[model samples]
Target: MNYDHWGRFLAQKVNEHTGLDILKWKNEKKHTWEALSWPDFYDKVNKTALALLDLGVKSGDNVAIWAENMPQWLVADMAVFSIRAVTVPLYANSPEVQAEYILHETESRIVFVGENEQYTKINAIREKLPSLKQVIVFAEPESPEEPDMSFETFVSAGSFANKAEELEKRRRDASMEDLATIIYTSGTTGVPKGVMLTHANFAETLRTHEILLDMNPGDTSIAFLPMSHIFERGWIYMCLNRGMTIYFNHDPREIQTTLAEVRPTFMCTVPRFWEKVYGAVNENINNGPAIKKKIFNWALKVGDSYYMNHKRVKKEPGVMLKLQHAVANAIVYSKVKKKAGLENAKFFPCAGAAIAPEVATFFHRMGIHLMIGYGLSETTATVTVNRYYDFNLASIGKAMPDLEVKVGENNEIMVKGKTVMKGYYKKPIETAEVFDGEWFKTGDAGYFGEDGNLVMTERIKELYKTATGKYVAPNYIEAKLAMDKYIEQIAVFGDRKKYIIALIAPSVQAIKEYAQKMNIAYDNLEELLSHSGIISFFEDRLQKIQREFARFEQIKKFKLLPYPFTVETGELTSTLKLRRKIIFEKYKELIEGMYVD
Candidate 1:
């Protein structure tokens, strides 16, 4: 229960308590699940930490970890924290320049490279990293060439007995005030600022959830999201504290299949995945024969009606409602949930951005307990999360217990609590600007509903003023546009222009289907995207959604991109958030062409 005692806490679970499984993973050979009885887990962590200490990695020194969601990454993370060294996680998908920026900013002494690609990235920028001393590559001897020492060699160099002694010494010196990790924010600004999270900061946040959610050691978690984000970091630590088993996903592409195999009790995800599930279901229904499509449509209507009226009034559903609801659940919803690998899902929390209220309602209607939370990295992860018992479709639930949240004079959500970070790392002026007295300004505009639930409107910084002096929130418009299955990514422009325009990326799968229906042949994706008929189809849909927005906020002109924004392209953040400035700069010419006379 004492989250501050992370070192002793994990050690106790590993040594004394042996019933609970700790971590699980699958490889080419077989699936492996390690219980608390496994001394190998503890041994690797201790030896790794001791090896770092032997290599001159000291308390307060930053240890950079560049890896995907693998067991070694978790081991390195725990070891770094155990040694009282600050852990800095670099997104595995990060560009070489971004990786260099993080390394230089963190002043990391030793780096842990996941594999060949990570090693290659570091090698490209190693010369520019003044503080970096050594790179410990995690791969087999047969693996591709890498920098410095191999992980096995580094651990082998340290005596296990000596490592145990060093771990004890580090634990004795560790305190609540010591910096735990520096999670860099994935922002549009070229320079990523590290959010310094102290041991007490994460400890209190995890403990708050532990009490609120009743998390236990018997619980299991499937971690797919990159651990570089504070959301996953906090969740992983919470799992560790509770002695829950964590299954590291092997193939991200096979997430659904992996979930079916693991059957994890709980997980967290962004709303985009949920949207994809919805789109897939819709596609299946559309592809079916006339009778099946009609049946599917009827079932959806029944489900929607039941969801809308369930708690309010017990209407004896007419024969139609009864028959339609049964058929829908049996044929559509059941198969959809099964395919989503949520057959045994206990709790699912959706965050990072606002989900469509209809999407939230749809899942809830299907007996899915999906809770929505709202927060940013500066808040250390979660400020407000919808409680399981007191759920609402339109609201982002109430604030977490012990956290203070209020709307500022300008409608910005300001929060002050143990969960808040220790200001931005090394940016005193910028930090002071956002911090008002005691509360940390969220920079998001929102208000509390009558039910005391937080209702987020838009980002204060993202709001744009039109030529007519009207303020418009692009996110609201963008969310509406994204609800159309054909639309993948849209950035609503027109900050000071006459009206809003947009940069849109259509879903390739959806576009290809449209092409097939129209009998328009295409050789490849590029030709498909360039087809005028396909572009016009999207334009019509854009106009239809434009009616829902205010006149000033309507997207007037738009440009369709050939490809969707991705992490590799440096257009989207690791969390799948758009880098507005980067996108605008990258497509400057295209954007100008849209407004040309």
Candidate 2:
């Protein structure tokens, strides 16, 4: 079915199968579940679409949405799709400069701003957006100072019944080939380019998800990742189509607490969140008395043995393996899963980047099905995923049904499927270079294992040649560094150097513990990062990490960056992928300092 049909189909399912409790926002202390049914959802979408149309939004016009994860954002998105308009979702935390570029490039006619912060951002660059005609804010207007219309005002201006009929009529004509979204690549090198995605692109991805994961109507999902990302966007639609109720996360800071309260059956997250959980667990173990620490360590060893012997190898467990696993799960693994708020989670999909194998194994040992997958935004967010039944911890899994995946001469992954993007918007030459006749060059280097699982090595473009003609894949080195509980972020550099070097960002919790143990006093993050003793500590840690790597891939020199890379900064993309080019340019001075004798 087409993308338009997917939305209508989901809406029909929600109306038939679900009661009023299809979607909820319990975090706000507002019980909105009973009041908002599928009919209500569809009505709002239709009215909102008509409101946008009334504001002169055309069928192909770009309508940008800058908001946190909220019900209104979903409504706005569906409304855009209803009229065959393209939705351009900007990261809520994006800088005004970056947001301005997206808005201007897409030539968005209407922008739905979440609250005051979002409105202020658009207002700052309103003059620069020639095609931007109206600003519809989701928050209630408190005073005359606010320069936007509230969501209530925007919807109230249109006839709900009339708009619903009008949109339903248009929906019948909306084709699978119609452009659904224009997601701007986070622009690691130059200005972000819009990647055009058709309705069929997303629909095909959702179908693949259904095959890989046994998604059903009874399952529930917690939306945590930014909806602006194609990963979450596709997943959200997948849930909607399958008749699953979605709980929108109101505050990311309280995600753990919220997860415990909601107890969702499914979730999607990046590796960093799991890494932080691992860091916390390790820190607690380190702080505990000797006996407790020893027991915890023993339990982990037992758990690892059980996973390797049984799950990884798919062998029948011997008597001793069974005994050890039972003891470990009861004593340690079960407790760990509970603390991580994943006891109720069936299978959590890990994407956006390569998960450290150790962490993946650790979670699997603890009975958490951490399904790791690999894809780019251009691939409609998913290309390969480990099936729930036949998952392998070491592999990213086999290609999805209907997707053609092959490794090139240099082991670069290439994909051809209905889900593959149309091309980069308005840049035919650039698009032509990347998108071959049918297959899209993933730029990611990987190989298909004997078992037919896709194992990603590194990005072909990210690989750098050293002065000695040795090729270094930074991701491989960085993944090893990430296995360290204290190391949060590490970037390797050796483009024209004799030896490799790195910039490290230590975990905040790890740094705090180090400061406490050493009796080092600090006023803030800046002072702690600049401390000579702390720097030496990281140096020693890096040396230890280097020992685990080959000679060429070892990091020879390094510096500790004061702050971690964030989406707010231009260093990282919306999907939490590093923009290496931007980072190298931004930190040229500090990077050069490491090379000087």
Candidate 3:
């Protein structure tokens, strides 16, 4: 816990601290888990560092990790930092082109991946990457050579007595000013930009985050969120700093199942994950028997009344309300929470994007704290977070200690703090453009509430003025509509147009269920979705959800997409956020058709 001028925090913690527990992960067969004790983890890091030295990697070099959240990812990250080499993380879902651009841009010397798919992707382009000396895969490689090598072999290649002494010397030589990592932003618009974060940037954020949230000694967490993201990466580091047990979830699709097993104290996530959980819970309720449905609804009503009285109403729940809640929890919410993998969760930080107000209230009613915080990758994962004691779900909460926030021109949120990135990697022109004096332009627009809590708002760049010069924030509309059980993803389109319209991607599972009930026949998802009855159903659902929004914000028309936006299709970023620019352009015809008649 030393906050001296500059030092290797991870190494210091491992060496100085005793009784550190193991990091757990499922073995290759997925039947059971393997664990790494602190001493074992420290040894892996040392070996990895020495391996890098064998690869001719030097201080200040960029090394990339293209994998999911695993013990090796953490080991490689700490190893790279131990030698003062920069760590660049690539999204596991990133295509070859995107991965190639970052690897080439950073001039990465060594790259590590988790599995075969990533290895194949990198191997396909290895010829183009002249500077990439070693491509290390977590598992055993088919053949160990200059281009492709197994991680175990890479570690073994570094087994030398001299390397350990050299590592110690390099640790002492490490400076806070040295570049620690290049975290790529989730490019929702154009190409992804690498944000340069220093050891000081991480140290400052870690120091502040430790104060904002309290994690107990034996608290555990499952990291299903993509580790390539700054949000997950920072959360992982924060857990490490707290001596919390970490569970590595190889597949995000299995989060619910894994959650049931891990029963973690907390998990960090995006609003979309909560949306799915809410939808699934509701779907089960809807499909339940009459008696069960009655109990579920009644339980929710009682829970909401009790929760609101305690949370927003600032009133103690009467004895009757408390009793009702206790019965409700025993029969419904508690069972649902336990099955959903959030039973032990104290609070999970929900950020990366805006959450629907209805969904936020839903979790709160269920006695789950979806702490709707806010931060960009450039801010080392968080600038503002909703604290446990004082928070409004509607707001992104107050800024962290030592952070300065102000509203500048156009109501754009400006921030200045130690957690802010040094600059965009090797892009001074772009870096200078984002700064206004000392404050880093957040590119988001919002106003402080009367209580001084920062209200989360739409990005300034995304605010579109219609043909009548009446500006509308598409994200606000999109968020509201996305809360519907039938809706999977939504994009509002009224920019320079007469009336607002939307491109909707209805939930495939929900649609399938509806089709079966209505006796609608179709061969494929597209055909099923395009049925007249299905269209009518969505029209009704859309109108109902739109009632929550202002008249102008309501969607007059919409086009239902047969398929959801995906990262592989270039319609979404690695973080699962819509690529608005790509989506708008790709669906240009469908959008124009909505306005035609």
Candidate 4:
């Protein structure tokens, strides 16, 4: 894959796919889809690059973007790339201290924010960040003042093309080695370290994905995941490289509606998103009439035979089977898919954590392509992803083209690839510790299967040892139990303890429906969870889910919390991975009580 300047590359794509809608967003007031053509996107990006130049943003300088997914956010990112500057993205909901730490660490000259909420957070800590000079707000603020101007104003200042030559020169002199982004890892412990990625890293990744994935120029994708995370950021870069129309989902709460409206051909999401979908579908199926259940089950069986048995193996189904599939799709599968807003889904990549095999199978059976993959922030998003037809629900599939993957000492999954990060920004000692020669130590324990597919066993650091000398992989247990409809989040703990125990945040709405059906009495959430019926119900569900686990690995006891773990509560990272140590510390008392014999 040859590297080219982002400006030139985007211009080429625009010329090739002229009049195509490259960017889209829903106008809340107008209640319609607003679009930007490829030419419009190219024009906006160029103007934004000039605007950054007008603000004295020089090459190699770091610019912070503290905003949610929006058309302007991508515009800013491309502009930063065109100017040969580094983009340091902070999660839109980043707490004040963490946001301040990144700005101060990067010595960012300017930060672009989304709405007033993000602007307010930056405002409160701007005084503490001496290097931060200007704030460009994407949305109009209640009171726009000095040093804090609207994004429109920032773009208009460049409309005169005052710094056009400077922007052009910067793009002309752009190098593949130039820092593309400094992504801060949302660590489970210790301070976040910035993973430095270069244009070469992104270029190689795009090339590999283009070779492996079958996406086309006219395909449509929805951007819902926070772009600060490498998974979404890298995927979006590839989406644009393919000239796909991207719908920016500004409000995550409206994703379901947006999905229905857009009927996107492609999107990327974490396992948690699918877990909710699985739980909800099961809930609806279970609550329906007897005939409905019968039809749904038969359709799924036919779908499994057609998709998994015949289609996946490249075997043509018989005439009877083909007829059954068509009937199933018409009466059952189509309605279910249309209701879930995935009727038009072509390929949906799921990553960040392990997805339940059942969940993956369910989506596949319904003809919603859920491609499960594995990687970390240091790996530039995907090291391996399940292929279109030949995929195993039990494995994360083979490594990307031209990438090396091997299991080293201690069963650590090591990767050597052009897509890997340059290094952790300014953390030489930390970076040195993670690498052994040319291979990057992924810190994940996995081994290549007989079929040459990688099956991740556990995060080496997350293994828990009990007092009885039994070691447990928390992620394994958690992923298995997360399939239950009642569990929203869980943290397994047993290190140096007598037995495995857990802190569970049950699905409140599901439980409420359960309560109503079971005729349970309760006035509030606290009372409902404490009811003996609810307790017994959870115990039964947990036991059923962990039936295959060994005695030592099974969770012996658990404490249910009234609320779910969240980013705001410091229990989960921005990517929705559990901060186990933080969760353990916060629930120490409850965890200790569960271990009492």
Candidate 5:
């Protein structure tokens, strides 16, 4: 792989698949899907590249993409890469201050915004940034403000300039040493730091995945996760490389609708998505008639035996068991799969946080390929992923071929590979701190199981140490409790304390239904949560979920809130990881009250 991984190979791929549909996007106004053939997509990329050239965006200059998941987002990214410029991706929903910080820090001369909201945000903060000069909005804004223009207008401007030769020269000049992208961390701990990844890093990642995963040119993928996130961004790169047809899912709230329509062969998503599906499926079965529950449970057992015992073990199922599996698939699994539009699902890469083993197992039992893996932005997305066969449900699969992964001091997962990021952009001290010799220290605590599978323990900085010197992994506890239908969002706290405590946000609808069924009356949710019977019910549920946990690790007290932790409330990161510090400070009183007893 050379520095021309994107400029050469990607361009070649587009040319090779010129007649094929490369991108699909839903038109919000028309309520129909629009597609772009490889040639059409390539034309846009070329025009966008020439546009950047016209804007005086030279090689090595930083260009910011503050947008959501959309085809234009990739077009702009590819354009930037083709010209060997560094791309700084800000979360589509990033606050003005954060976006301003990234633009200012990178000294970005131009930025591509997704829509009006992003344009407005950047436009409002333009005065604060000395270097930011142009704003390119992906959508046609009602009014094109000064220093900003519609994406179409920007693209059209390149057509008259005749800078096509310059764009080509820059593309040919692309090198592996060129800085590719500067992805800002979600900053669950604090201020976001830009993780600098080079073209070489992406090239190696693409190669490694091609070897480890089963993917083909005609495969279909739905881009549901925000492309600003490395998991999706990197995965999409591989999809393009493999000539996979990608459907851009614009609004995440409508992912289920898009999922059913696309019925994609592959996708990348977070654990929260699966958690919701698992909860919904379980709720329906639990609330249904006894006979239905019994039938569903029986089908699940049959699936487990056939898939886990026979198929997974490479042993043929006996005739009787095969007959049972066929009945289960027809009567239960097939219906569930079709309802969720997972009937065509080949494999889905799940990561970003720990998914409950039970949830992963549920998908596996239903003949769904849910490949659980682990990695970080600094590692270019995936370091380990479960294979199509011979995978351990409890572990985060095997390391990618040729990627060095090992447990380091403090049980931190360490990596030394081509996929590891070059360093944080313009932050030498921070970059130096995350590396020891050649290994990039992944600030996660984990160890390998006896079967050579990586078993993640907890995030090193997030591990809670009790006053009694007991260590508690809150993620393990929270992941388990979150599976309960009532517990929508939970954060465990007990650092230097007697025992663990949790702040829970109950599922409002589920709680309301429970109240109706139990004959508990309440004027409002807050009042309902304060009821003695509700507290006891939650306590009973918590005890049952934590029965396997050590006594010290069990949550001693909990406070249920009527509200959920939201990204807008500063309690969760853009990626939905809990910001423990802010959450603790926000509810200091409630946490203190829990400690009073």
Candidate 6:
């Protein structure tokens, strides 16, 4: 392994440990899984790097990748870094205008796309882009498209044999100061800003999270989230640095099936994935026959108690209980684990949003380690994660070894560490505003718990004041409300209006079971959701859940959405946090209707 740069050198060492496949992907057409060994991966990256050099992509140039999680995406990103170029990643769900703005703003000379879907977006704005020189697509073209070449042609066309010396020189010249990536924020408010992170920023994160990084050669993970997002990108890189095989999921909707097939040891994702899993579990238990329901509940109750006690004090259950647990595991809990692909999973990392403590505990109770942490794009990845056997569900965990975190004014979590970014790219004024001298203001409001773990409260900007001057932290309530299995997704609205209200997306499957049990008639989702029976059920549940809150904190009224909030619909970020303004504006009338006389 060569210590050429603060980053790539470490990956070289782990890749040499095992000669197994570095990347594994499914061929949808062939109905088979395909893999790229390290040698094959290196060869591809070499060709891609040469191809970029051939196309006049000089050192330190900005190149963007507009694609999902795929082998080509990783190859292109590596190829860019090999020549000390900055890799800009555009979200696959980004609209044409947003993509156009990012490409134009970054002044990227070259861009790589996945297929026709991305090609169409670029083609629409190609004429408007002056800095963009070429469009290289991965998949074969369906139609006669100008100014485009297939991924194969782009690689084979490069002549790199004679320029080996030049490539080597570029690699040797890379330093910690070199910009590695410029990730744009998933803007829930205004325009998205590009966060410029250096190689050192990334390297520090990998080294700091070294405990979780002890993945063996047999460890595998599914890259299902947007690789463009720093959270997923950093986790995938960690897998590579630990000699773990990576399985790429092209379509995130099939992540469940993919998980079952791969039986991955680790997966880093947002809280929404687990929330859905919890909802499904509840649905199954609620819908099963009376005896089956009783068995499932008994198993879960025993498992939960065993794990909680085990984790807290490292104690073992008594023989009688142990035998019962074994029987329950064989009868019910084993099925639960295998169904969600956690049967072989050693652990999981969930971040990018505040995960409800109940959800985190639910997994821990079932013997799956769900490490819910906190991070932002600016920090490059994870800032804090629950570690060891002590599953502290309330806190995001103690800060990483070298990082320093403090509660600044308004309870903002202030940070000063190596992992913080150089600053937002080309936005000096905004960057300066976010920092109080050396400490970067995280904008998240929280205080350190008595146990010294960081308890993330909510986004400071999301703390709203009502017309009557009663302040409410929506995320605090939202996090608690998300724990209910019947609630799929919810947006707690009532900023300057009156008392609290909510925009709810109920768990359709769970609601279906409820309807069946209660003998409520419904044909479609719209009918089920509109029925008075289910509405009253949710209303009663909401009241009970918010019983601990102040009078003003309780949700007064709510609107039930027939569909779930998604990134494509501009209601959720890639990590599943609510896009507040978009949801508010989109459903402005519904919110107003709730307050009508």
lDDT of each: 0.80, 0.80, 0.83, 0.88, 0.89, 0.84
lDDT of each residue in 369-444, candidate 5, tens digit only? 7889999999998998888778888899899989999999999999999999989888999999999999999999
Ranking by TM-score: 4, 5, 3, 6, 2, 1
Which should have the higher TM-score, number 2 or number 3? Answer: 3
lDDT of 3 by residue, 255-286 (tens): 87788888998888888788877877887888
Q: How big is the positional error of residue 484 in model 5, measured in Å on the Cα after superposition?
A: 1.6
Candidate 5 — which residues are off by over 4 angstroms? 1-3, 212-214
* Predicted candidate 6 versus true structure: per-residue lDDT over 69-125, tens digit per residue: 889999999889888899999988777878888998999989898888888888889
How far does residue 444 in candidate 5 sit from its true spot (Å)? 0.8
lDDT of 6 at 425: 85
TM-scores, one per candidate = 0.92, 0.93, 0.95, 0.97, 0.97, 0.93
Best candidate, lDDT: 5
Candidate 2 lDDT, 29-109, residue by residue in tens: 564332356777877777887887667666778989899988888989998888878999998888899999888888887
RMSD from true fold, candidate 4: 1.5
Better of 1 and 6 by TM-score: 6
Task: For each of the candidates, give the backbone clash count.
Answer: 0, 0, 0, 0, 2, 0
Ranking of all candidate structures by their lDDT, best first: 5, 4, 6, 3, 2, 1
Candidate 4: misplaced stretches above 4 Å? 1-3, 158-160
- RMSD of every candidate to native, in Å, equals 3.1, 2.6, 2.1, 1.5, 1.6, 2.5
What does the lDDT read for residue 514 in candidate 2?
76
Backbone clashes (count) for model 3: 0
